[model samples]
Target: MAYETVIVEIDEGIATITLNRPEVLNALNSQVFIELGEAAEELSGDESVRVVIITGGDKVFAAGADIKQMASATAVDVSTNVRPSLRTFNFIENMHKPVIAAIAGYALGGGCELTLVADVRIAADNAQLGLPEIKLGILPGGGGTQRLPRLIGAAKAKELIYSGDFISAEEALRIGLVNKVVPADQLLIEAKKMAQKFAARGAVAIQMAKTCINEGLQMDLDRGLQYEHKCFSLLFATEDQKEGMKAFLEKRKPNFQGR
Candidate 1:
């Protein structure tokens, strides 16, 4: 499907969603959120798509939310317009297929929050990431406050958010905000490589594992273990699981149908 603010491409078993508003540094807006949610929903329902990558042009992942859109808005306007946009992030996070963020340049405010929704994030060496909402007399309303602390630690997240400082890709890596940082030119290549690795796995198992990890994190250890156990046992009923085990016994790579 064609999108005005974003581009969606599917190849092999990977789907890539590119934010296409470079004129404004690919700033997030209501339209961007709408398109993103549509793209994610469409890809999630496609059986052929094993993984999804969200990215922007080489110059930036996204600078931030469009300030102009919010500048003249009242609290009621923001609640009516901006708040609903967060559903896109939630959709991406809960997608059955893993979502990877290939970030370059700046990923600030809402952009940073966007990356947090991805299952994995790989950034360019030149990338800068932060939640600088406080600098604008606002706070991150797009999951940054929640996901950031979960990814790094609460203290680090607080420091970054409170200071409104941008962290280098290396610093982000050190703080565990991003999975890996590569040369700018190789960012997409690395992202695609990781996506391909996921594509080759048992799709059902991969989705189940993602569910277990994401949902399990919200529960106590005992409850989480029980949930994991249930998900694990449920997979035994899938053809992919049976094929995977048989393939292992036969000393061959398994062909997963994602059933």
Candidate 2:
């Protein structure tokens, strides 16, 4: 589908969603979130797409949310205007396939929160990331307070959010905010490489694994293990699981049909 604030491209089982508002440094807005949710919903039903990547142009992933759209808003506007955008973020997080964030330049405030939704994040060496909403007399309205602490530690997440300070890509990597940091020009390439790796795996198993990990982490250890075991047992009913094991025993590559 054609989108005004974003671009969607699907190739070799990978769907790339590029935020495309270069004039404002690809800032997130209500329209962008709506488009993103639409794109994600489309990809979710596409059997050909096994992995997804969310990115921006080389100069910026996204500067932040569109302040112009929010500056004159009242408390009522927050619920009417902003809550739907948060729902989009939730959709991205709950997507069936894995999502990777290919970040380059400034990924601040809502931009940083967007990355937190991804399963993996690859950033360019020149990237600067943070939730700087506190400077605007607001907090992150897009799952940052929840997801950031889960990625890094609570203390680190609190410090960054409270200070509204942007961290370098290297610093982000050290703190476990990003999975990898590559040269600026290689960001997309690396992201695609990772996406391709995921695409080659057993689709059903990968989905189950992602579900087990994501959902399990929020539960107690014993309950989490029971949930993992249930998901593990459920995979035995899938063709991909049998094919994967058979191919492993035969020393040959398995062809997963995503069944």
Candidate 3:
């Protein structure tokens, strides 16, 4: 599908989705959210794309939600707005393949929420991440409340929200908020490298692992372990597992087809 707010490009088992609204700091409007969902739907269905990297254009990853739109919106708009954005986020998190957020400049409010949805986040040295929605007289409408504490712990998350402070990429890495930090100019290159690494792995195993991790997190230990075991057992039935084992014994790299 053709996208206006975003650009989706696929190559070598990876899909790069760049938020293209640099003029507005790649702000999340309802239309942007809709386009994000449409792009994710297509990427999720394309077997050639084993991994996805979400980034922003120009100097900012995203300055957050479109402030003008949000300021003019009503309660109904607020309620309706979150649904599409969260749906888009969940689409990335719940996809069989991994999604990586390559953040630079600003990743505030809704944009920060978008970063949290990815399975992995890699930010540039200058990236500024925060949940500043409270400053706007509103809380984060996306998954901020739920995902932030989980990413950076309750105390730190609370500090950021209550104070509306932005942390640099270095601090984010120290707190385990982001997986890696790269030079400002190399953010996309580094993000693509991570995507390629994920693409080379056993796709089915990785997908099941992601499922187990996501679903099991909401359950008790015993139930979660059982789900993990089920996922492990299920993988034995896939052609990739057979090929993986054969490739192992043959002393050669496994070429996973994502079958």
Candidate 3 similarity to native, TM-score: 0.97
* Each prediction's TM-score versus the true structure: 0.99, 0.99, 0.97
Q: What digit string (tens of lDDT, one per residue) describes model 2 on residues 103-201?
A: 999999989999999999999999999999999999998989999998898999999999999999999999999999999999989999999999999
Over 49-103, each residue of candidate 3 has an lDDT whose tens digit, in order, gives: 8999999953799989998887787888778777888888888889888999999
Tell me which of candidates 1 and 2 scores higher on lDDT.
1
Which ranges of candidate 2 are over 4 A from the true structure? Answer: none
Per-candidate Cα lDDT values, in order, are: 0.94, 0.93, 0.90
Tens digit of per-residue lDDT, candidate 1, span 109-157: 9999999999999999999999999999999989889999999999999
What's the best-to-worst order under lDDT? 1, 2, 3
**Which candidate has the top score in lDDT?**
1
- The positional error of residue 200 in candidate 2, measured at the CA in angstroms, is 0.3
